[model samples]
Target: MSLGRRSVVTLAAAVLLLGGCGGGGQEAGAGAGAKVTVEWWNIVTTEPLKSIWAEKVKEYQALHPGVVIKNVPIENEAYKARLTTLNQSGKTPDIFTTWGGGVLKQQVDAGLAKDVSDEVAPWIGTMTPASLQAYQFDGRTYAVPADIGMVGFWYNKALFAKAGITAPPTTWSGLLDDVGKLKAAGVTPIALAGKEKWPGHYYWAYLAMRIAGLDALEQAAADHEFGGPGFVEAGRRLKELVDLAPFQKGFLGASYNTPDGQAATMGNGKAAMELMGQWAPVVQKEAGKDLGDDLGFFPFPAVDGGKGLVTDAFGGGGGYAVGQDAPAEAVDFLKFLSQAGNHREAVASGAVLPVVKGAEDAVKDPNLAVVARTLASATGFQLYLDQAYPPAVGQEVNDSVAELIAGRKTPEQVAQAITATAKSE
Candidate 1:
């Protein structure tokens, strides 16, 4: 069932035709007599997801005998650029993965996506309200989330034990104490790959959340009010962390691929922890280790007087959505893929937090189940800032974070630059 490059190209061409075939108001559940060809594009270069998607695609083909799925795995760095170009050329895939927050709003407004409200409504009541809201634009649904994840601290249990640390820290001061212990034990406290920019940017987002609360971070990113006391304090705290050398040597120059290779450093026992999304386990697996019994997780520690709550999570899922111009058959295939069972299967294979309710129970991996539980119990959820803001503003924030990490910009300079970008938008 492994599809070749030619098959992929052929499927993409069919998807293009399906996308250009407009004016037929056929429903998504059209009969099996119609053979649909769906061009499904996703960014899955990393492990677990890539292998998971490959399996899921095979299952989808078996279930829908007449349906042909064109799977295109886009590189993370090139996804946005290529997507934009494909969209402009009117060759956008019939069904593609998309972020579920304000990012989807832009596509909805541009009429690039189909309103899947009706198609997704049946499963709506089964999902968490926050999960449902993440995919909404103007009170209408444009996509169905396949996974829902939360950002938190992922630590190596073996490393903690070696350092004689018995429990995970629940407060800010406790976190610093643990970091000090790990540092004394000759272990890097955090594994940060700053060259990728977004990973370093995550530190800022979490710090901002701890200092100002979710509302302030949201407003600052959305409204550009970066001069507030909350932001300044967050920036100061970030600088303190940076000064501590919590990260590995030469971390600033290391890429995401570096962390994956340095698996022994983080997974076997060299690093104590990483502040990352729930997807860290997959990354660890890619590093050639099982990570069994050595993994543990905890929410980010609370800032002493900050307004943010420990229950607030920062992360969102991307899901598959059909194009408005897609052919009737392709649209039908998209709907088939959204069925509860299919969706759950897809998520379970990917080790992703499933958007469907029962899928959490279906998760065999304890780590993934922990992620699901966290997402299920979160009091509030915020999409990643880059995915929450307009593309231009997001790009500016990414660059600012990169410069901040490189020591090329002061905290004040980064804050001011972010505010300027928000105001200009």
Candidate 2:
């Protein structure tokens, strides 16, 4: 999620497209007059999107010569909190980063975001439908997706070989066995940033998705319930991993990219694997030693008797939506950002997964390309649990799962905790 994130209570849908928000009421290049500045809010503060985005903004302004794009970059947690505050007043930047789900729906409900359908009609056919799913609701589009990807196991092949594990696991039992082997070989089996909660939640969420399937999770949300047997089973499976004591020391307090945290741990070759999305390798290199050719990726293994297929993917991507009062130029800038050539540059720079139909050829990273192709063939897709559910329920899921991983909560207790939160919401 170079442009998106794992945080919650932000995205939403729209039932009716808004008027005057059809996009492109102004000329492509503005005439000499007062400078029209587009207040752009986004979370591309990390590389390679950070640097690539800055250069692209400069080029767009240079091409227009009369538009000023003010970019307000924020971190993951901070971005969520800030947007939440602004959303209270029904205000957002002209072009803001959106994960494009219930948050976008809420924004549309509040009349705070523009309907981008009319503006994107011509070029919409050039992008993949799956990549565009999160941005659309009730037959209307609100956001332009920049990156699309799914989460899976990113491992160190060298470490796996050292552990005598010849291949990645294909079943839940095999995964546990592999973890034990890695530990016996003096390696931390998994790199987890427990303080962050989101990374750890991946385990239980993926387990739930595996045991319960995507449709079950959606149904649970619709009914505000998580005490289902599948959820308890998911937690019990995660507990088995936790019982092995596989994560790095101090994992409970670990940060995602800090020097001693998750990405760095794996990137530095101290851990065998991590369950992460397409950004893993990029952040691995950014935060620690580059794994180079030793890096490998595999889909999360199927449970022995699970409902989800190995073909089902779990993750989301980044997109941009306009404010309801945003100038048509704002929508124009979005178009500029998503043009096939521009998106190709982002792909080549290793900042994003391919979103446009033909941009997959632009991918330069082998690991990311694996993820791209995996997504291309996925039979089902699940946005991150946090981004998929209401904010409180999502956070509760994270917190309760963390407690379970720490041996502070039982599997039944965790499911009940999440159910309690969900029902209250």
Candidate 3:
């Protein structure tokens, strides 16, 4: 998942990064009592986060008059492209947005990112552990999470009732049965953005999590071996759902947040459910009609005879990573941003989910509150595979899985493609 925004192929170019901090010096701390400018790059060109982040920056600056926070807000896809170019040239903004998975790991490996394990030590524990997983590597922290979320089913209650389904399914078989019911009732069972390959991968990823287990998925990524029985079975299971013709017409070419895309389809009530992250409802309201009280959420169903439990959540969130040589004040600003009081505003706006402990109450939406509760008790967690694996390997997972859904590839072939790419990487 893109966490809150739709991802694009341009992000794959992120693999080319090789850089260090771009502005300020080691002496650029507030204590120095000298003017220091820290360039902050982020994807917050949209509302809620856009305005909220600006306010936080203003607050941070007011507290340290000597420090000038140069905030650079860019659109999501454009930000990736710009970052890729900067990174390829051996330079990065002082403090930049990060997804904190394989992408951050690559920057860490290339000596581009700062290792803030000690810098953040004092208050790092104040964050939810699951939200910090993606940013940690080999016992070191690379970034600080500003928001966190998990992927699950967002459905329409009225549609379910119309289909004669009394409640959401908790098991794989039950889910398939519900799909049958929805289809028989003449409702599109699910909405998918096949044109945006990332959305389709959610199904395969969740299925692998349910059937093969979270550990298996992690081990496969680490071992560069995805052509295992468990993974293949995950693909086969997804194929079973695909065979049901569950998605709307033109789904294979549909976008994610466009007016006639996946979110719109579900928001308009043409489809009963969509497997999306915590950002679904907001995007639905933006791209189409808000389902209002008709909206509901549920955890992905558990697979029979599988190693994973329903409590194993899968998703990732936004965070900030300081460049290798950025000013210490840059790190301080990140801390200020993560503080419970400051972060709560973002959560309260319903623009982001809580990453820090004690901010959970900020999630006021009924459905979002359910997500927060689920995350609080999650037994295991997996960041989105596209962000967890190397850029090439992750793209392969999306591409191969999309092909499988399009009837252009078999489960075994999908696994083989991903395994080959992983090994090459």
Candidate 4:
């Protein structure tokens, strides 16, 4: 499970290829020298991305003195609701955040998104191709990615040692055993934001990926069915963990970035680990004490005899897409943000995983570097289920999985619920 130098070198090679954007007709400050306002929306209410993004806005405005970039930072779930509402109302912010999968596809289909293929072509070649995969459609680009990463277990090394565990687990059964050992050592084995629903879905999603294989999930989605035996087994496996009572007390009511929530629980050492994405460490530090050297990361363990390999990755990153009605400055601003110098600031802040060529060096956090390496060596990649599937179907997966975790639904029922929803969609 150790991410070796080979993987790191692989990642370095992937990001070292040669390319900038916003060059043709209008510059970022164009418009008869009159002041232009660009409303940029993103889910960055938390630091260090929040502050770093704000500084970038200021810097952009400073350089393009005639442009006023309005930065709107929203909380995670709230941002989803707000954006959904806007989309339903036939409106969108000038520039907004996107996960760049089914949701982005829907927007493009509805004519709510802009195609930036030509605008970004000059520099898109410089980015990691995998990072751009989610944002591209019909051989055209729809968004500019600023971050890229995967979801995995962020664990406490000290807590693992206290539980007499010498190495991270590589198999599902080993992970369960380690959970038990941690609990026996009087530690809350895992911190989960059950109330958030999405975080809870990661467990089920990763389990499904590990058990059913990546191709199976994709086929299931395409077939509008999720009630296959493999998916049911994935739920049963999650149920096995849930039955162990591994999460922190009141986990069902916990938020993600709040003071008493998942990241905080893991950050304060109230729990040994959390299944989250690359942002986990940053939020943990912001919401609670910095674990510093005690922090460690490991990929999700593989299920024994499963079709999936241990190297398959499950996650996605944040990207920016311009609205159809947005002014050209919106695209220009995205180009400006995509510049290595500006983006390196976010990467250096440990808030972004490198997407730009030569930007990998900006990743200073060891755990994040491990993520980058592991991602590079992945045998397959699946975007987060909630993003990979249509909005309704993805929400159904989250809701059904949450019910399964809450002990209100059987493994079979969880699969059935998801399948039913997918079919209706």
lDDT against the true structure, per candidate, is: 0.69, 0.83, 0.87, 0.82
List model 1 lDDT by residue over 1-425, tens digit each.
00110011111112221223222333367774755666777776666667767776787789777766777898644565566656655445677767755456666766777897776565566766556656676678777666677778889888888778999998877888888898888778888777667767777777788788877876676566787888777767777777777887777776654444333346645578887777677666666465778898888888888898878888766666677776555556555555677767766565466776666676777776787877777788877777777656666667887787677887888888888887997
Where is model 2 more than 4 Å wrong at Cα? 6-38, 45-82
TM-scores for the candidates = 0.81, 0.86, 0.93, 0.81
lDDT of 4 by residue, 97-176 (tens): 88787878888998988999998888788777767877887799998987788889999999999999999998989999
Error of 3 at 345 (Å): 1.4
TM-score of 4: 0.81
- Cα shift from native, residue 326, model 2 (Å): 2.5
lDDT of 3 at 53: 87
Location of the lowest summed lDDT over 10 successive residues in candidate 1: 1-10
Determine which window of 10 residues in candidate 2 has minimal summed lDDT: 15-24
Which digits, one per residue and each the tens of the lDDT, describe model 3 over residues 277-342? 988998899899999999999999999999898898998888888898798998999999888888
Give every collision pair in model 1.
none
Which pairs of residues collide in model 3? none
Distance from true location, Cα of 312 in model 2, Å: 1.8
| Model 3 score (lDDT) | 0.87
lDDT of 4: 0.82
Better of 2 and 4 by TM-score: 2
Rank by lDDT (best first): 3, 2, 4, 1
